[model samples]
Target: MKRIQSGTLRALSNKEEYFETTDLQRSIRQGYASLLSGEIEMPTPFDMGALIGPILNEGTESEFRAELTRRIRRFIHNRHPPLNVDVETVERHLIRRLLRTRKGQTTLSGIGVESSGSSQDWLQGIAPWRAVRDAQKEHSSVLASLGDNTRADIPKNILSHSMASVCGTLSLVPSADISELRSALGPVRTVSERHTQRIVKYLHEHTDWVHKHKSLLGREAPRSILRQRYRAVGMTLLAIWPLKEAIRKWMEDNPTTHLRYAMGQIVRSGQYPSAINDTLARISLIGSGTDGRSAPAGPSGLVTWWQHSA
Candidate 1:
Protein backbone atom coordinates (compact mmCIF):
# COMPACT_ATOMS: atom_id res chain seq x y z
CA MET A 1 0.00 0.00 0.00
CA LYS A 2 1.22 3.52 -0.73
CA ARG A 3 2.01 5.51 2.37
CA ILE A 4 -0.14 8.65 2.77
CA GLN A 5 0.87 11.51 5.00
CA SER A 6 -1.54 12.11 7.88
CA GLY A 7 -1.97 15.77 6.83
CA THR A 8 -2.70 14.68 3.27
CA LEU A 9 -5.23 12.08 4.36
CA ARG A 10 -6.87 14.56 6.70
CA ALA A 11 -7.16 17.11 3.92
CA LEU A 12 -8.70 14.52 1.66
CA SER A 13 -11.12 13.39 4.34
CA ASN A 14 -12.49 16.87 4.80
CA LYS A 15 -15.36 16.94 2.31
CA GLU A 16 -14.76 20.43 0.92
CA GLU A 17 -10.99 20.08 0.58
CA TYR A 18 -11.46 16.59 -0.80
CA PHE A 19 -13.58 17.72 -3.74
CA GLU A 20 -11.36 20.63 -4.80
CA THR A 21 -8.18 18.60 -4.62
CA THR A 22 -9.74 15.60 -6.29
CA ASP A 23 -11.23 17.67 -9.04
CA LEU A 24 -8.00 19.58 -9.76
CA GLN A 25 -5.92 16.43 -9.61
CA ARG A 26 -8.33 14.72 -11.96
CA SER A 27 -8.17 17.60 -14.42
CA ILE A 28 -4.38 17.64 -14.35
CA ARG A 29 -4.22 13.90 -14.84
CA GLN A 30 -6.74 13.96 -17.66
CA GLY A 31 -4.83 16.76 -19.37
CA TYR A 32 -1.57 14.82 -19.12
CA ALA A 33 -3.18 11.62 -20.35
CA SER A 34 -4.66 13.44 -23.28
CA LEU A 35 -1.25 14.90 -24.16
CA LEU A 36 0.42 11.51 -24.04
CA SER A 37 -2.30 10.03 -26.19
CA GLY A 38 -1.91 12.86 -28.68
CA GLU A 39 -5.53 13.78 -28.07
CA ILE A 40 -4.59 17.30 -26.93
CA GLU A 41 -1.43 19.28 -26.40
CA MET A 42 -0.31 20.38 -22.98
CA PRO A 43 -0.48 24.07 -22.09
CA THR A 44 2.60 25.51 -20.46
CA PRO A 45 2.27 27.00 -16.98
CA PHE A 46 2.76 30.41 -18.58
CA ASP A 47 -0.03 29.62 -20.99
CA MET A 48 -2.25 28.74 -18.06
CA GLY A 49 -1.24 31.97 -16.37
CA ALA A 50 -2.06 33.95 -19.49
CA LEU A 51 -5.45 32.32 -19.52
CA ILE A 52 -6.20 33.20 -15.89
CA GLY A 53 -4.03 36.14 -14.89
CA PRO A 54 -5.94 38.95 -16.59
CA ILE A 55 -9.23 38.03 -14.90
CA LEU A 56 -7.54 37.74 -11.50
CA ASN A 57 -5.79 41.05 -12.02
CA GLU A 58 -8.77 43.00 -13.29
CA GLY A 59 -11.91 41.41 -11.80
CA THR A 60 -13.30 42.35 -8.41
CA GLU A 61 -12.32 39.98 -5.62
CA SER A 62 -15.88 38.62 -5.45
CA GLU A 63 -15.86 38.10 -9.19
CA PHE A 64 -12.48 36.40 -9.14
CA ARG A 65 -13.60 34.00 -6.42
CA ALA A 66 -16.90 33.27 -8.19
CA GLU A 67 -15.13 32.65 -11.47
CA LEU A 68 -12.62 30.36 -9.80
CA THR A 69 -15.43 28.33 -8.29
CA ARG A 70 -17.20 28.22 -11.64
CA ARG A 71 -14.13 26.99 -13.46
CA ILE A 72 -13.48 24.24 -10.95
CA ARG A 73 -17.08 23.11 -11.07
CA ARG A 74 -17.06 23.19 -14.85
CA PHE A 75 -13.82 21.27 -15.10
CA ILE A 76 -15.09 18.59 -12.78
CA HIS A 77 -18.32 18.27 -14.73
CA ASN A 78 -16.55 17.95 -18.05
CA ARG A 79 -14.07 15.29 -17.02
CA HIS A 80 -15.97 13.05 -14.70
CA PRO A 81 -19.31 11.86 -13.41
CA PRO A 82 -21.05 14.24 -11.03
CA LEU A 83 -19.28 14.32 -7.70
CA ASN A 84 -21.42 13.74 -4.64
CA VAL A 85 -20.41 17.08 -3.17
CA ASP A 86 -22.23 20.29 -2.41
CA VAL A 87 -21.37 23.20 -4.69
CA GLU A 88 -21.20 25.62 -1.78
CA THR A 89 -18.87 23.36 0.14
CA VAL A 90 -16.45 23.05 -2.76
CA GLU A 91 -16.54 26.78 -3.34
CA ARG A 92 -15.90 27.64 0.29
CA HIS A 93 -12.85 25.40 0.47
CA LEU A 94 -11.50 26.61 -2.87
CA ILE A 95 -11.91 30.23 -1.80
CA ARG A 96 -10.08 29.60 1.44
CA ARG A 97 -7.24 27.86 -0.32
CA LEU A 98 -7.05 30.64 -2.89
CA LEU A 99 -6.96 33.35 -0.20
CA ARG A 100 -4.17 31.60 1.65
CA THR A 101 -1.94 31.48 -1.45
CA ARG A 102 0.71 34.16 -1.97
CA LYS A 103 -1.18 35.83 -4.84
CA GLY A 104 -4.48 35.76 -2.96
CA GLN A 105 -2.81 37.11 0.15
CA THR A 106 -1.30 39.94 -1.84
CA THR A 107 -4.64 40.81 -3.45
CA LEU A 108 -6.48 40.74 -0.11
CA SER A 109 -3.74 42.65 1.63
CA GLY A 110 -3.88 45.36 -1.02
CA ILE A 111 -7.53 45.93 -0.08
CA GLY A 112 -6.51 46.07 3.60
CA VAL A 113 -6.58 42.64 5.16
CA GLU A 114 -9.34 42.04 7.65
CA SER A 115 -8.53 39.54 10.31
CA SER A 116 -12.15 38.37 10.13
CA GLY A 117 -14.66 39.18 7.40
CA SER A 118 -16.49 37.48 4.53
CA SER A 119 -15.46 38.12 0.92
CA GLN A 120 -18.55 40.27 0.36
CA ASP A 121 -17.60 42.40 3.35
CA TRP A 122 -14.10 42.85 1.94
CA LEU A 123 -15.54 43.80 -1.47
CA GLN A 124 -17.90 46.34 0.12
CA GLY A 125 -14.91 48.06 1.68
CA ILE A 126 -13.09 48.65 -1.60
CA ALA A 127 -14.86 50.03 -4.71
CA PRO A 128 -18.03 51.79 -5.74
CA TRP A 129 -18.16 49.69 -8.90
CA ARG A 130 -20.27 47.23 -6.95
CA ALA A 131 -22.92 49.84 -6.30
CA VAL A 132 -22.91 50.70 -10.00
CA ARG A 133 -23.28 47.03 -10.83
CA ASP A 134 -26.16 46.61 -8.39
CA ALA A 135 -27.95 49.58 -9.89
CA GLN A 136 -27.57 48.10 -13.36
CA LYS A 137 -28.99 44.79 -12.18
CA GLU A 138 -31.99 46.56 -10.73
CA HIS A 139 -32.73 48.11 -14.10
CA SER A 140 -31.95 45.10 -16.30
CA SER A 141 -35.55 43.97 -16.65
CA VAL A 142 -36.84 47.36 -17.75
CA LEU A 143 -34.05 47.68 -20.28
CA ALA A 144 -34.71 44.19 -21.58
CA SER A 145 -38.38 44.96 -22.10
CA LEU A 146 -37.53 48.22 -23.88
CA GLY A 147 -35.11 46.40 -26.20
CA ASP A 148 -37.72 43.79 -27.05
CA ASN A 149 -40.12 46.52 -28.07
CA THR A 150 -37.74 48.90 -29.87
CA ARG A 151 -35.03 46.72 -31.41
CA ALA A 152 -36.96 45.75 -34.52
CA ASP A 153 -37.98 49.34 -35.10
CA ILE A 154 -34.40 50.65 -35.14
CA PRO A 155 -31.98 49.93 -37.98
CA LYS A 156 -28.84 47.93 -37.16
CA ASN A 157 -26.30 50.60 -38.07
CA ILE A 158 -28.13 53.20 -36.04
CA LEU A 159 -28.34 50.71 -33.21
CA SER A 160 -24.56 50.24 -33.28
CA HIS A 161 -23.91 53.98 -33.03
CA SER A 162 -26.45 54.31 -30.24
CA MET A 163 -24.72 51.55 -28.29
CA ALA A 164 -21.30 53.09 -28.81
CA SER A 165 -22.71 56.38 -27.63
CA VAL A 166 -23.96 54.63 -24.52
CA CYS A 167 -20.54 53.07 -23.92
CA GLY A 168 -19.02 56.59 -23.99
CA THR A 169 -16.92 55.46 -26.94
CA LEU A 170 -18.62 58.16 -28.96
CA SER A 171 -18.76 61.57 -27.36
CA LEU A 172 -22.20 62.98 -26.49
CA VAL A 173 -21.68 66.53 -25.31
CA PRO A 174 -24.61 67.81 -23.28
CA SER A 175 -24.94 70.83 -25.52
CA ALA A 176 -24.89 68.84 -28.78
CA ASP A 177 -27.97 69.05 -31.00
CA ILE A 178 -30.07 65.94 -31.64
CA SER A 179 -29.09 66.30 -35.31
CA GLU A 180 -25.50 66.19 -34.17
CA LEU A 181 -26.29 62.88 -32.49
CA ARG A 182 -27.69 61.62 -35.83
CA SER A 183 -24.60 62.82 -37.70
CA ALA A 184 -22.41 60.90 -35.24
CA LEU A 185 -23.89 57.75 -36.83
CA GLY A 186 -21.07 58.26 -39.34
CA PRO A 187 -21.02 57.85 -43.11
CA VAL A 188 -23.35 54.89 -43.39
CA ARG A 189 -25.10 55.16 -46.75
CA THR A 190 -28.92 55.19 -46.84
CA VAL A 191 -29.94 55.42 -43.17
CA SER A 192 -33.76 55.41 -43.02
CA GLU A 193 -35.22 58.74 -41.90
CA ARG A 194 -37.48 57.02 -39.35
CA HIS A 195 -34.65 54.82 -38.06
CA THR A 196 -32.52 57.86 -37.48
CA GLN A 197 -35.36 59.45 -35.58
CA ARG A 198 -35.73 56.29 -33.50
CA ILE A 199 -32.03 56.31 -32.64
CA VAL A 200 -32.24 59.91 -31.51
CA LYS A 201 -35.33 59.20 -29.48
CA TYR A 202 -33.82 56.13 -27.85
CA LEU A 203 -30.67 57.97 -26.92
CA HIS A 204 -32.63 60.79 -25.33
CA GLU A 205 -34.94 58.48 -23.40
CA HIS A 206 -32.20 56.20 -22.06
CA THR A 207 -29.78 58.97 -21.26
CA ASP A 208 -32.37 60.82 -19.14
CA TRP A 209 -30.69 59.26 -16.09
CA VAL A 210 -27.53 61.18 -16.90
CA HIS A 211 -29.49 64.45 -16.88
CA LYS A 212 -31.22 63.54 -13.62
CA HIS A 213 -27.80 63.14 -12.12
CA LYS A 214 -26.39 66.04 -14.17
CA SER A 215 -25.11 67.99 -11.24
CA LEU A 216 -23.28 64.94 -9.95
CA LEU A 217 -21.73 64.21 -13.34
CA GLY A 218 -18.86 66.64 -12.82
CA ARG A 219 -17.84 65.29 -9.45
CA GLU A 220 -15.58 62.26 -9.72
CA ALA A 221 -17.04 60.35 -6.78
CA PRO A 222 -20.65 60.70 -7.85
CA ARG A 223 -20.05 60.35 -11.61
CA SER A 224 -18.08 57.18 -11.19
CA ILE A 225 -20.80 55.69 -9.02
CA LEU A 226 -23.54 56.22 -11.58
CA ARG A 227 -21.85 56.30 -15.00
CA GLN A 228 -21.99 52.55 -15.65
CA ARG A 229 -25.50 52.38 -14.28
CA TYR A 230 -26.46 55.28 -16.48
CA ARG A 231 -25.02 53.50 -19.49
CA ALA A 232 -26.81 50.25 -18.74
CA VAL A 233 -29.41 50.60 -21.47
CA GLY A 234 -26.82 51.55 -24.06
CA MET A 235 -24.68 48.65 -23.04
CA THR A 236 -27.65 46.36 -23.52
CA LEU A 237 -28.33 47.81 -26.95
CA LEU A 238 -24.73 47.30 -27.96
CA ALA A 239 -24.78 43.67 -26.89
CA ILE A 240 -28.09 43.05 -28.64
CA TRP A 241 -27.17 44.87 -31.84
CA PRO A 242 -23.77 44.58 -33.53
CA LEU A 243 -22.32 42.07 -31.05
CA LYS A 244 -25.24 39.63 -30.91
CA GLU A 245 -24.66 37.90 -34.22
CA ALA A 246 -21.00 37.34 -33.51
CA ILE A 247 -21.62 36.09 -29.99
CA ARG A 248 -24.34 33.74 -31.26
CA LYS A 249 -21.99 32.21 -33.82
CA TRP A 250 -19.25 31.74 -31.23
CA MET A 251 -21.65 30.16 -28.76
CA GLU A 252 -22.90 27.74 -31.42
CA ASP A 253 -19.42 26.58 -32.35
CA ASN A 254 -17.90 26.52 -28.86
CA PRO A 255 -20.94 25.68 -26.80
CA THR A 256 -19.06 24.28 -23.82
CA THR A 257 -16.27 26.84 -23.69
CA HIS A 258 -16.19 29.22 -20.75
CA LEU A 259 -16.06 32.13 -23.18
CA ARG A 260 -19.28 30.93 -24.70
CA TYR A 261 -20.87 30.52 -21.28
CA ALA A 262 -19.93 34.05 -20.25
CA MET A 263 -21.10 35.54 -23.54
CA GLY A 264 -24.37 33.65 -23.18
CA GLN A 265 -24.97 35.22 -19.78
CA ILE A 266 -24.33 38.69 -21.21
CA VAL A 267 -26.60 38.11 -24.18
CA ARG A 268 -29.37 36.77 -22.01
CA SER A 269 -29.25 39.85 -19.81
CA GLY A 270 -30.38 41.93 -22.82
CA GLN A 271 -29.29 44.94 -20.82
CA TYR A 272 -26.00 46.23 -19.57
CA PRO A 273 -25.17 43.05 -17.76
CA SER A 274 -22.50 42.93 -15.08
CA ALA A 275 -20.21 41.09 -17.46
CA ILE A 276 -16.84 42.74 -17.01
CA ASN A 277 -15.64 39.95 -14.78
CA ASP A 278 -16.76 37.24 -17.18
CA THR A 279 -15.52 39.18 -20.18
CA LEU A 280 -12.09 39.56 -18.58
CA ALA A 281 -12.01 35.86 -17.88
CA ARG A 282 -13.01 34.98 -21.42
CA ILE A 283 -10.46 37.38 -22.90
CA SER A 284 -7.72 35.98 -20.70
CA LEU A 285 -8.51 32.47 -21.87
CA ILE A 286 -8.84 33.01 -25.62
CA GLY A 287 -8.17 36.57 -26.73
CA SER A 288 -5.20 37.26 -29.02
CA GLY A 289 -1.77 36.38 -27.61
CA THR A 290 -3.13 34.37 -24.71
CA ASP A 291 -4.02 31.16 -26.52
CA GLY A 292 -2.29 32.03 -29.78
CA ARG A 293 -5.75 32.14 -31.34
CA SER A 294 -7.50 35.41 -31.93
CA ALA A 295 -11.02 36.04 -30.69
CA PRO A 296 -13.72 35.98 -33.34
CA ALA A 297 -13.08 38.93 -35.65
CA GLY A 298 -16.42 40.59 -35.02
CA PRO A 299 -16.67 42.71 -31.85
CA SER A 300 -13.12 41.76 -30.72
CA GLY A 301 -11.89 45.29 -31.33
CA LEU A 302 -14.91 46.72 -29.51
CA VAL A 303 -14.32 44.38 -26.59
CA THR A 304 -10.62 45.26 -26.47
CA TRP A 305 -11.42 48.96 -26.62
CA TRP A 306 -14.06 48.62 -23.89
CA GLN A 307 -11.63 46.81 -21.56
CA HIS A 308 -9.02 49.53 -22.00
CA SER A 309 -11.45 52.40 -21.55
CA ALA A 310 -13.40 50.85 -18.69
Candidate 2:
Protein backbone atom coordinates (compact mmCIF):
# COMPACT_ATOMS: atom_id res chain seq x y z
CA MET A 1 0.00 0.00 0.00
CA LYS A 2 1.24 3.55 -0.77
CA ARG A 3 1.71 5.47 2.49
CA ILE A 4 0.10 8.95 2.46
CA GLN A 5 2.27 11.73 3.86
CA SER A 6 0.97 13.86 6.75
CA GLY A 7 0.82 17.04 4.67
CA THR A 8 -1.24 15.38 1.90
CA LEU A 9 -3.57 13.85 4.49
CA ARG A 10 -4.15 17.22 6.17
CA ALA A 11 -4.70 19.02 2.85
CA LEU A 12 -7.22 16.41 1.77
CA SER A 13 -9.08 16.68 5.07
CA ASN A 14 -9.24 20.47 4.78
CA LYS A 15 -10.42 20.25 1.17
CA GLU A 16 -13.20 17.82 2.05
CA GLU A 17 -14.32 20.13 4.85
CA TYR A 18 -14.21 23.14 2.55
CA PHE A 19 -16.35 21.40 -0.06
CA GLU A 20 -19.05 20.89 2.54
CA THR A 21 -19.25 24.62 3.21
CA THR A 22 -22.23 26.58 1.79
CA ASP A 23 -20.07 29.12 -0.06
CA LEU A 24 -18.06 26.52 -1.95
CA GLN A 25 -21.22 24.51 -2.59
CA ARG A 26 -23.00 27.53 -4.06
CA SER A 27 -19.98 28.42 -6.18
CA ILE A 28 -19.78 24.88 -7.45
CA ARG A 29 -23.45 24.98 -8.41
CA GLN A 30 -23.12 28.30 -10.21
CA GLY A 31 -19.88 27.28 -11.94
CA TYR A 32 -21.36 24.01 -13.12
CA ALA A 33 -24.46 25.76 -14.46
CA SER A 34 -22.34 28.29 -16.31
CA LEU A 35 -20.10 25.61 -17.77
CA LEU A 36 -22.89 23.24 -18.83
CA SER A 37 -24.90 26.11 -20.32
CA GLY A 38 -21.91 27.11 -22.49
CA GLU A 39 -21.67 30.53 -20.87
CA ILE A 40 -18.22 29.55 -19.53
CA GLU A 41 -16.12 26.94 -21.29
CA MET A 42 -14.60 23.90 -19.62
CA PRO A 43 -10.86 23.81 -20.19
CA THR A 44 -9.10 20.71 -21.45
CA PRO A 45 -7.54 18.69 -18.66
CA PHE A 46 -3.78 18.93 -18.15
CA ASP A 47 -1.79 16.10 -19.78
CA MET A 48 -1.13 13.72 -16.87
CA GLY A 49 1.13 11.49 -19.00
CA ALA A 50 4.16 13.47 -17.85
CA LEU A 51 3.38 12.69 -14.18
CA ILE A 52 4.12 8.99 -14.78
CA GLY A 53 7.85 9.58 -14.47
CA PRO A 54 7.65 11.22 -11.02
CA ILE A 55 4.88 8.92 -9.74
CA LEU A 56 6.95 5.87 -10.67
CA ASN A 57 9.91 7.33 -8.82
CA GLU A 58 7.80 7.52 -5.58
CA GLY A 59 7.75 11.31 -5.37
CA THR A 60 6.67 12.85 -2.04
CA GLU A 61 2.95 13.63 -1.64
CA SER A 62 3.59 17.36 -1.24
CA GLU A 63 5.81 17.34 -4.32
CA PHE A 64 3.11 15.58 -6.35
CA ARG A 65 0.45 18.05 -5.23
CA ALA A 66 2.71 21.00 -6.03
CA GLU A 67 3.53 19.58 -9.45
CA LEU A 68 -0.15 18.97 -10.22
CA THR A 69 -1.06 22.52 -9.26
CA ARG A 70 1.79 23.92 -11.36
CA ARG A 71 0.82 21.88 -14.43
CA ILE A 72 -2.89 22.81 -14.15
CA ARG A 73 -2.03 26.50 -13.86
CA ARG A 74 0.23 26.23 -16.90
CA PHE A 75 -2.50 24.43 -18.82
CA ILE A 76 -4.94 27.23 -18.05
CA HIS A 77 -2.49 29.94 -19.12
CA ASN A 78 -1.83 28.21 -22.43
CA ARG A 79 -5.53 28.20 -23.32
CA HIS A 80 -6.12 30.38 -26.42
CA PRO A 81 -8.15 33.00 -24.55
CA PRO A 82 -7.27 31.71 -21.09
CA LEU A 83 -9.71 29.84 -18.82
CA ASN A 84 -12.57 31.94 -17.41
CA VAL A 85 -13.16 30.03 -14.15
CA ASP A 86 -12.01 31.36 -10.81
CA VAL A 87 -8.54 30.05 -10.02
CA GLU A 88 -9.54 28.95 -6.53
CA THR A 89 -12.62 27.10 -7.78
CA VAL A 90 -10.64 25.23 -10.44
CA GLU A 91 -7.85 24.38 -8.04
CA ARG A 92 -10.28 23.06 -5.45
CA HIS A 93 -11.94 20.66 -7.90
CA LEU A 94 -8.63 19.53 -9.43
CA ILE A 95 -6.98 18.92 -6.09
CA ARG A 96 -9.99 17.03 -4.77
CA ARG A 97 -10.07 14.76 -7.82
CA LEU A 98 -6.35 14.16 -7.58
CA LEU A 99 -6.61 13.35 -3.87
CA ARG A 100 -9.44 10.90 -4.46
CA THR A 101 -7.48 8.98 -7.12
CA ARG A 102 -4.28 8.90 -5.05
CA LYS A 103 -6.16 7.44 -2.09
CA GLY A 104 -7.64 4.70 -4.32
CA GLN A 105 -11.15 6.03 -3.56
CA THR A 106 -11.53 6.91 -7.29
CA THR A 107 -9.97 5.57 -10.48
CA LEU A 108 -8.77 7.57 -13.44
CA SER A 109 -10.07 6.47 -16.86
CA GLY A 110 -9.07 9.48 -19.00
CA ILE A 111 -9.31 13.26 -19.07
CA GLY A 112 -12.42 14.35 -17.14
CA VAL A 113 -13.34 10.73 -16.44
CA GLU A 114 -13.04 8.50 -13.37
CA SER A 115 -14.18 5.03 -12.28
CA SER A 116 -16.64 6.55 -9.80
CA GLY A 117 -18.34 8.50 -12.62
CA SER A 118 -17.41 11.48 -14.80
CA SER A 119 -15.64 14.46 -13.23
CA GLN A 120 -18.92 16.32 -13.79
CA ASP A 121 -20.46 14.24 -11.00
CA TRP A 122 -18.55 16.48 -8.56
CA LEU A 123 -21.23 19.11 -9.29
CA GLN A 124 -23.52 16.84 -7.19
CA GLY A 125 -26.98 17.03 -8.90
CA ILE A 126 -29.18 17.55 -11.97
CA ALA A 127 -29.31 21.37 -11.71
CA PRO A 128 -26.40 21.89 -14.09
CA TRP A 129 -28.01 19.61 -16.69
CA ARG A 130 -31.27 21.55 -16.42
CA ALA A 131 -29.30 24.81 -16.87
CA VAL A 132 -27.85 23.42 -20.10
CA ARG A 133 -31.35 22.56 -21.34
CA ASP A 134 -32.50 26.12 -20.60
CA ALA A 135 -29.52 27.56 -22.41
CA GLN A 136 -30.30 25.47 -25.49
CA LYS A 137 -33.90 26.69 -25.48
CA GLU A 138 -32.72 30.32 -25.26
CA HIS A 139 -30.19 29.79 -28.08
CA SER A 140 -32.86 28.21 -30.31
CA SER A 141 -35.24 31.10 -29.71
CA VAL A 142 -32.55 33.63 -30.68
CA LEU A 143 -31.75 31.68 -33.86
CA ALA A 144 -35.43 31.59 -34.78
CA SER A 145 -35.64 35.35 -34.35
CA LEU A 146 -32.66 35.80 -36.65
CA GLY A 147 -34.15 33.49 -39.27
CA ASP A 148 -37.45 35.35 -39.29
CA ASN A 149 -35.77 38.81 -39.61
CA THR A 150 -37.81 40.16 -36.71
CA ARG A 151 -37.03 41.16 -33.09
CA ALA A 152 -40.62 40.84 -31.86
CA ASP A 153 -40.00 37.41 -30.36
CA ILE A 154 -36.43 37.82 -29.11
CA PRO A 155 -35.78 38.05 -25.38
CA LYS A 156 -34.88 41.52 -24.18
CA ASN A 157 -31.69 40.39 -22.44
CA ILE A 158 -30.79 37.74 -24.98
CA LEU A 159 -27.75 39.64 -26.29
CA SER A 160 -26.39 39.86 -22.76
CA HIS A 161 -26.55 36.05 -22.39
CA SER A 162 -23.11 35.44 -23.92
CA MET A 163 -21.61 37.69 -26.57
CA ALA A 164 -18.95 35.23 -27.74
CA SER A 165 -21.44 32.41 -28.09
CA VAL A 166 -24.01 34.64 -29.78
CA CYS A 167 -21.39 36.00 -32.19
CA GLY A 168 -20.16 32.49 -32.98
CA THR A 169 -23.71 31.42 -33.83
CA LEU A 170 -24.21 34.53 -35.97
CA SER A 171 -20.97 33.85 -37.87
CA LEU A 172 -22.73 30.94 -39.55
CA VAL A 173 -24.96 33.50 -41.33
CA PRO A 174 -23.93 34.60 -44.83
CA SER A 175 -22.50 38.14 -44.72
CA ALA A 176 -24.08 39.16 -48.05
CA ASP A 177 -27.62 38.54 -46.83
CA ILE A 178 -29.88 41.09 -45.13
CA SER A 179 -30.38 38.48 -42.36
CA GLU A 180 -26.78 39.02 -41.30
CA LEU A 181 -27.34 42.75 -40.92
CA ARG A 182 -30.60 42.19 -39.06
CA SER A 183 -28.95 39.73 -36.71
CA ALA A 184 -26.05 42.06 -36.02
CA LEU A 185 -28.26 45.10 -35.49
CA GLY A 186 -31.01 43.29 -33.55
CA PRO A 187 -28.75 43.12 -30.52
CA VAL A 188 -28.75 46.88 -30.22
CA ARG A 189 -31.54 47.08 -27.64
CA THR A 190 -31.62 50.86 -27.59
CA VAL A 191 -32.42 51.21 -31.30
CA SER A 192 -35.87 52.85 -31.80
CA GLU A 193 -38.53 52.13 -34.41
CA ARG A 194 -38.09 55.56 -36.05
CA HIS A 195 -34.35 54.94 -36.36
CA THR A 196 -34.94 51.50 -37.84
CA GLN A 197 -37.51 52.80 -40.32
CA ARG A 198 -35.21 55.66 -41.34
CA ILE A 199 -32.35 53.21 -41.78
CA VAL A 200 -34.56 51.03 -44.00
CA LYS A 201 -35.58 54.02 -46.10
CA TYR A 202 -31.97 55.15 -46.40
CA LEU A 203 -30.90 51.69 -47.51
CA HIS A 204 -33.61 51.67 -50.20
CA GLU A 205 -32.53 55.09 -51.45
CA HIS A 206 -28.87 54.10 -51.47
CA THR A 207 -29.67 50.94 -53.42
CA ASP A 208 -31.54 52.99 -55.99
CA TRP A 209 -28.67 55.49 -56.18
CA VAL A 210 -26.16 52.68 -56.70
CA HIS A 211 -28.23 51.21 -59.53
CA LYS A 212 -28.70 54.61 -61.17
CA HIS A 213 -25.01 55.65 -61.01
CA LYS A 214 -23.32 52.27 -61.40
CA SER A 215 -21.32 53.63 -64.33
CA LEU A 216 -20.23 56.85 -62.54
CA LEU A 217 -19.36 55.23 -59.19
CA GLY A 218 -17.63 52.34 -61.01
CA ARG A 219 -18.63 48.72 -60.59
CA GLU A 220 -15.64 48.20 -58.31
CA ALA A 221 -16.40 51.06 -55.91
CA PRO A 222 -15.08 49.64 -52.64
CA ARG A 223 -17.78 48.14 -50.44
CA SER A 224 -16.12 49.91 -47.49
CA ILE A 225 -16.75 53.31 -49.11
CA LEU A 226 -20.39 52.47 -49.67
CA ARG A 227 -20.77 51.37 -46.05
CA GLN A 228 -19.15 54.55 -44.79
CA ARG A 229 -21.44 56.65 -46.99
CA TYR A 230 -24.47 54.77 -45.69
CA ARG A 231 -23.44 55.24 -42.07
CA ALA A 232 -22.78 58.93 -42.65
CA VAL A 233 -26.23 59.43 -44.15
CA GLY A 234 -27.90 57.35 -41.43
CA MET A 235 -26.26 59.34 -38.64
CA THR A 236 -27.23 62.63 -40.31
CA LEU A 237 -30.82 61.54 -40.64
CA LEU A 238 -30.83 60.51 -36.99
CA ALA A 239 -29.86 64.03 -36.02
CA ILE A 240 -32.37 65.63 -38.42
CA TRP A 241 -35.36 63.24 -38.36
CA PRO A 242 -37.79 66.07 -37.58
CA LEU A 243 -36.63 67.81 -40.76
CA LYS A 244 -36.54 64.61 -42.83
CA GLU A 245 -39.68 65.47 -44.83
CA ALA A 246 -38.27 68.88 -45.77
CA ILE A 247 -34.92 67.32 -46.74
CA ARG A 248 -36.67 64.64 -48.84
CA LYS A 249 -38.77 67.31 -50.64
CA TRP A 250 -35.64 69.36 -51.27
CA MET A 251 -33.78 66.33 -52.63
CA GLU A 252 -36.63 65.54 -55.02
CA ASP A 253 -36.98 69.16 -56.31
CA ASN A 254 -33.26 69.77 -57.06
CA PRO A 255 -31.75 66.47 -58.06
CA THR A 256 -27.99 66.53 -58.55
CA THR A 257 -25.99 63.84 -60.31
CA HIS A 258 -24.78 62.50 -56.89
CA LEU A 259 -26.16 62.25 -53.32
CA ARG A 260 -23.26 64.04 -51.60
CA TYR A 261 -23.30 67.01 -54.00
CA ALA A 262 -27.03 67.43 -53.45
CA MET A 263 -26.44 67.43 -49.66
CA GLY A 264 -23.71 70.08 -49.93
CA GLN A 265 -26.01 72.25 -52.05
CA ILE A 266 -28.69 71.91 -49.37
CA VAL A 267 -26.23 72.90 -46.64
CA ARG A 268 -25.04 75.85 -48.64
CA SER A 269 -28.63 77.04 -49.17
CA GLY A 270 -30.45 75.81 -46.00
CA GLN A 271 -31.37 77.72 -42.81
CA TYR A 272 -28.82 75.70 -40.78
CA PRO A 273 -25.69 76.65 -42.73
CA SER A 274 -23.34 75.58 -39.92
CA ALA A 275 -24.90 72.08 -39.70
CA ILE A 276 -23.06 70.94 -42.85
CA ASN A 277 -19.72 71.90 -41.34
CA ASP A 278 -20.61 70.27 -38.02
CA THR A 279 -21.64 66.92 -39.57
CA LEU A 280 -18.52 66.88 -41.75
CA ALA A 281 -16.41 67.52 -38.65
CA ARG A 282 -18.23 64.79 -36.67
CA ILE A 283 -17.63 62.14 -39.35
CA SER A 284 -13.89 63.08 -39.73
CA LEU A 285 -14.32 64.25 -43.31
CA ILE A 286 -13.83 68.01 -42.71
CA GLY A 287 -10.91 69.56 -44.61
CA SER A 288 -10.08 66.17 -46.16
CA GLY A 289 -8.70 67.46 -49.47
CA THR A 290 -5.35 67.79 -51.20
CA ASP A 291 -3.11 70.76 -50.20
CA GLY A 292 -4.93 71.05 -46.81
CA ARG A 293 -8.07 72.43 -48.47
CA SER A 294 -11.64 72.08 -47.18
CA ALA A 295 -13.68 69.18 -48.67
CA PRO A 296 -13.88 69.17 -52.45
CA ALA A 297 -17.06 70.16 -54.36
CA GLY A 298 -17.89 66.56 -55.40
CA PRO A 299 -19.71 63.53 -54.06
CA SER A 300 -17.42 62.97 -51.08
CA GLY A 301 -17.53 66.62 -50.03
CA LEU A 302 -21.29 66.87 -50.59
CA VAL A 303 -21.94 63.77 -48.47
CA THR A 304 -19.93 65.27 -45.62
CA TRP A 305 -21.67 68.61 -46.12
CA TRP A 306 -25.11 67.03 -45.95
CA GLN A 307 -24.28 65.10 -42.79
CA HIS A 308 -23.45 68.38 -41.02
CA SER A 309 -26.19 70.43 -42.67
CA ALA A 310 -28.88 67.96 -41.69
Each model's lDDT comes to: 0.36, 0.34
Lowest lDDT block of 10, candidate 1: 220-229
| Global Cα lDDT for candidate 1 | 0.36
- Candidate 2 TM-score over all chains jointly: 0.21
Model 2 global lDDT (CA atoms, 0 to 1): 0.34
Instruction: Say which candidate scores most in TM-score.
Output: 1
RMSD of 2: 26.5
Q: Could you tell me which residue pairs clash in candidate 1? A: none
Candidate 2: where is the Cα deviation over 4 Å?
A: 1-190, 193-247, 255-261, 285-310
Q: In each prediction, how many residue pairs overlap at the backbone (N, C-alpha, C within less than 3 A)?
A: 0, 7
Candidate 1: RMSD to truth: 24.2
lDDT tens string, model 2, 37-101? 76876666632122222222135556666777777756543433223444323323433343344
Off by over 4 Å in 1: 1-140, 143-162, 165-175, 188-193, 206-245, 251-310
Report the Cα lDDT for residue 171, model 2.
21
Question: Considering only N, C-alpha and C atoms within 3 Å, which residue pairs clash in candidate 2?
Answer: 260-302, 260-303, 275-308, 275-309, 276-308, 276-309, 279-308
